[model samples]
Target chain A: MAIEVNGKMIEIDEEGFLVDREDWSEDVSEAIAGRDGIELKDEHIGLIDYFRDYYEEHQVHPTMRVLVLRLGGKIGKKFHDHKEYEKFLYMLFPSDPISELCKLAGLPKPLPSEHDG
Target chain B: MAKKNDEKGTTNPELNIPLLNELEEGQWPSFVSDLKQWSKTKPQVAQLLNQLEESYENRWNYWTGTVLNVSGYGGGVIARLSEKADKYPDLAEFHTIRVIPPPGFVYSTERLRNLADICEKHGAGILQLHGLTGDALALGFDNEGTFAAAEELMANGWDLGGSGPALRSLQCCVGQARCEMACFDTMKTTRFLTNHYISFLHRPELMYKFKIKVSGCANDCANAMIGSDMPIIGTWRGPMQIDQEKVAEYIEEKGVEHVIDNVITRCPTNCLSLKGKQMVVDNENCVRCMHCINVMHKALKPGKDRGVTICLGAKRTLKIGDTMSSVIVPFMKLETEEDFQNLTDLIDRMWEFWNDNGMDHERIGEFIARVGLATFLEGCGIDPDPRMVQSTRTSPYIKFEELAPGLFEGEQTQQPKVWNREPDTREPSD
Candidate 1:
């Protein structure tokens, strides 16, 4: 399947992850997030940037705990605790923060395991 | 779907399930016989039996399906849809609902009957006394029936067990209820943990399935040491109490040779010795392997200072290899609420570290292997201890930088530094 962004057809997998990483752009991310009724905010973009960078370096997506711990250091100082930061992240994404950020970052769909309920 | 006979009347007239029939011929109790009995009343069981027979004949499993959890819960239902649904329509959507049994599996007859009624009403009337993880398995339900069964179970003050990536069912060996050697209350611990981590049990958020098992004593009746990610085994500190009179009595009853061959020789640490018909244990050298104590139960009793030993990273073979639990906390008093809170705090640290570093499909044991035990310990805020290792370090390649206090920070050593040590403070050799 595919989604149209900037009047160009961009391919996505069945779960709506980008079929090709090279096809990713800011416009494509916004278009993808739009489908999920999420408006791309600076915080969301910041998380997306972190995800893309981490994936590029480690060849694996950062888990939700890692995202909260690492990014909470920078942007989460206002929150009372790491859990509050995590709750804020949930408020932004509402659904699975890691997967949502990864999708907006235009990375491959996170591998599903029996543990991924 | 109400319970009904085969709608198509396609119950095979020439049902040739030789292998399944062979199972019924065994002397021991046979699940095949039970299924055959249930099949007389439940068509679902008949279809399941037929599917299993076909699977045995084909040498392949016919069960396949997707995750089908009840509303607002992530686990406790294992979906089982037969690939040959066209041939056996009744087995099309047979799923298993895992019900969390009471701690130590003590069930009242009334409670058990309630479970049976629910199974009969919404499932195939099939029940497993206990699954591998200690949950009562209610088998054979479709999607809608699964939700209905769960609702009934919850209404009856019962909850579903763990599935998927969540914390799997917590198991505990019968403690003070029946066992004299029970060091702590295993059932109480199980109940406490179950109530505390109820969300983790129902919510699938962990990197992989986390299992907790509590054994009343080092005998490990629950198989916690090798089967679970977190193993809480009852142990004691200080010297074990020895009764010389009972020892003499045992020696007189069992004979010298029998005692020597069976008890003395079986001491894994060679800490026991027969001194004039009385057994003497070298307390310092004893490793508490439980062999000698088990044989001379009347003579040897556990130390008064009883506590539990907590271990981590035990799991079945996956990724790295089969690994036994490694001691993290050698002994911790599990009697008071404060002690339980401490344990939960440690568990929280462990979960946080694992959730951050663990990969998909990677168990906590595998994660420890990948990240190194030191890093894991650091993440969990635990100090390195000698008890955590099997033996003294063989390799000298230690991460001294991490261990040394303020050495890299350029703090000067104290006056009694090792290199610039003071002269012997002890008086001349006497």
Candidate 2:
């Protein structure tokens, strides 16, 4: 199948994802995050990159737990608190975001959209 | 559909005569034993006989699936499935359809013809009507047969929802749809949830049981009192949606006494004040029984807060027990799918934790109490909630305003009178 990253699409195999973040523009990342009711920010780069890497390797995006566990202690202890954690969550995944994030990410439209915002 | 129950005879020697499986038989021999004797009586069909016998012993009345719908609450497909269950001799588990009757519609011209036709063609004619959820039940059909009827009904564009773990259909008040107390868009919400959670209806693995109820106004005519796990009682927080001209028209059309009797006196909260054509509701005292708004549809509109109050733990066995509805989410705004999803996710997490950890047949609320809400939340890996249980747990540092909104201020919530309340303790009506 062809990997559609940004506007410039490339052919890719089913076994591996179309990684190489260089292929994903800031617009693409922001768009994908926005769909999950999340926004992308300069500060969210690390978490987003982490999510991207985990997805590329494991073949599935990090769920809330993995997101928390991977970034919790790193982001400081306050991240564990529901209110604060939710704030951080809302920060990385804006209330809503860009567009065509799923197509940019080469995924299907079967699950609940993340961009509830 | 026409498979004969050839082993219907009391004695099929190929099957074993029933033998007692346990030594300490009570007033009734072990169901296994009774079945074994049945097997002997029908030795040729011993295997088939034993399956039925074991099913009868293992879990009857413990839990049974009832397909619910707004119409045929008293009579419909449920009655049909029940009528034919005896014919499918091979199946072990039997299913019954519980019909949800359309509110305020005790009688309708349609006579639930679609379901009746399906029943007449596919199931036994035995109908059980007006179940707890106002659903009608069709006894005598096994699980597969019932499912077939469901599929069969789907072909005719008639759906039977509220069977399993998925979102049950949203029930509406006899609202402006029928009654006068309705304000918010109930039929729309009901349609929304029903269409939204179509995937959940057949997937039974989600939890022990999940129920949803909607009432146009707080009159809770649908028995949000103790009917559903998440009770969405319509409430108006902002300005009333009352259209004065419409109110006059409604009164002129619906009559004054009907409105007064059904809307005013019926209000649990004495907030409605009526003087001929003009009526006022003390917003402060209006407990949202929805009567005034429903009856005075032309005059009284639902307040801006026309959303529903989502209180958890309204199970017939657990939350409904001991008296009183323990309101969880005091109020919720279901204006969007995201809101519904958030609410459903919370329900999903609760079920994942409780169903896995709880003893069989425990309601989610009861399980939370048993496992400790804190531990259960921890197990579910949800955001921390310091105060969820009602068992007198309180924080020393917190004041009413500072407290977690989910927490109760002490165990001082008002208790509702159970349906089975003692007549001696009951007060006489004025």
lDDT of 2 by residue, B132-217 (tens): 55455554454456667766766765555444333444555665677555645566666666554443442222335556777777
The superposed Cα distance between candidate 2 and the true structure at residue B236, in angstroms, equals 0.6
- For each candidate in the order shown, give its overall lDDT on alpha carbons: 0.79, 0.49
lDDT of 2: 0.49
Q: Looking at model 2 chain B, which ten-residue stretch has the lowest summed lDDT?
A: B72-81
lDDT of 1: 0.79
Best by DockQ: 1
Docking class of 2: incorrect
> Can you give the TM-score per candidate against the true fold?
0.77, 0.46
> How many clashes show up in model 2?
70
Off by over 4 Å in 2: A1-117, B1-4, B7-111, B134-136, B142-151, B158-170, B239-282, B290-301, B318-324, B336-359, B371-430
Go through the candidates in order and give the C-alpha RMSD of each one to the true structure.
7.5, 17.8
Winning candidate number (lDDT): 1
i-RMSD values for every candidate model:
5.8, 15.9
